[model samples]
Target: MNKYILNKQQKLTTEKIRNLADSIGIDALGFADASEFTGYTIRNSRRRDPKLSLPEAETIIVAGFYIGGLTLPAWSNFLYGRTSRLYLSGFFLDVVKPLESIAAFLREKGYHAVVCDSSDSERSVLPLKRAAVRAGLGWQGKNSLLLSKKYGSFMALGGIITDAVLEHNTEEEPDRCGSCSRCQEACPLHALEQPHVLKRDTCLSNFLQIEYFPENAQSVSENRVGDCEICQDVCPWNRKHLENPLKTHMTALFQQKIHYWEDIFYLPNLIKMTEEEYESIFKDLNTGIPYSIFHRNVFLAMERAKKS
Candidate 1:
């Protein structure tokens, strides 16, 4: 039988959980009814060991927050640059402890609640933007990111899926990206085949993370590094959010990771370090920039810089 029953305590528990999440550094906790998520297209397309995650999450609380601003330091342009992407950086890292704490507390409370691993392999959880939509947080913008009329897509998503059935206070918004194609038009590689229809293989960010680089990219520029935020950057909604706290979400790595590119005019530095060294220096921050990717992008940058 389902372990949880909805009651006044559930309402109080939701508020307490939200309060605790904020105390942990989350900016907002919006609930989405995901009774229909986690099947069909998503389940069949990806493969992840379900044992690595919890099961049967009936109610999902989506978290959206970010860190942007001057505190947003540019990724280092010079090799051995003393800035690090190999670790968490920026504002988002501030909330990790609090997020974890809330999860632990809920476990103690006998609720079958758990955080959806943002990087889960099956990625079985509903997309975070969809979660926001179910919660009435905002409308999905053209970029396929949930754009709060007040906020934007420059946000990170975290969620707690629970067995507690709660009312959905959602007001779905129409796509507000009418006649405006900034996100698509501004894409560096024409990655957006059509609005909300990105050609995944061509997407720079996806390419950086999941696939091998093109032979042609071996000679391309380095300004676009491990992850590309170009599409998100050009959205009219995102543009207006330049000053919003969420725009510059930094994690622990932002405050303390080393960027190395002292002499990129020459491409030989790519060969200067052994793979073992690469693994050692970058092992900790492998969450985003795994060594192979980090090295390949940097090496590619060095190659392109000289050609330019």
Candidate 2:
């Protein structure tokens, strides 16, 4: 194929990939070539004790799906109170199915796309997510979330890295969060000191996701033990454009006033939460992600309730 014709096909292939992701339930999609971060990766690698960035990756495709919203039944009136691990709050399992499907599709099309794993894979997830932002899926929010001008931070990220020599797309998204302090103000533990950066010591999500909390963060478990949504919950951009099932599921967190401990703590019951009942709780439009994390969170919540 001639260079010009190949470039045209590459663009079409990019669009095809993006469309496939959407058709499979990805709420947001983006394309980025790994070459964009090579220099930074090298420089950072030299300075760190160990590095996670992959030097040879050529393209990183990022897709995000929604988790769900918070309704009157989901939150605790107490600043540090019990909040359940219902469907809306946990959908990590659902997003993975579509992600794997997309990756398989790309591989069948003759690309070696890799999904980075912070736990299982040698490559870093940050670079993958960073590559996603570079492809214009969203801007890096102060809270370290890739917040799309089109969708707030209420999305889960899935990534694919490939060596396909494709022509890069130049379209970039404008950071529409102009002077917005909602995310900064919403953090219960003060994680976001500035826009697009996070202080892990104070990040609630970090606190729950990590098994061992720092000595100073003994309060972390007593307080925000599960997932933290305060920052993303308050974004104006997230308040809009929630018509998409995934986006609506995520944006629903802020549309309520409620006082209740999480209703379900036992994991075994999830197998029975009816489709409507499950969707009403977690906001997951599809059953791709599982409720494992939420169940884990429930165990913690139940522990907290016991202590109280």
Local lDDT at 231 for model 2: 74
Q: Candidate 2: how large is its RMSD?
A: 7.3
What's the residue-level lDDT of 48 in candidate 2?
18
TM-score of each: 0.74, 0.65
Would you list the C-alpha lDDT of every candidate in the order shown? 0.56, 0.55
User: RMSD in angstroms, all models?
Assistant: 5.4, 7.3
Model 1, which residues run further than 4 Å from truth? 1-6, 38-40, 43-56, 70-98, 215-221, 243-284
Tens-digit lDDT track for model 2 on 1-308?
11233477677777777778767767777765564455343344421111234455566676776544443332442223333222234443333556777678767887776665322223445453466667777777666677775556656676666766554545666666778788888776677876777787687666555555454544554434355566765777667533343335344443442222243323234334554664466554332333554445445555555566
Lowest-sum lDDT 10-residue window in model 1: 78-87
State the displacement of the C-alpha of residue 106, model 2, in Å, after optimal TM-score superposition: 2.9
The TM-score leader among the candidates is 1
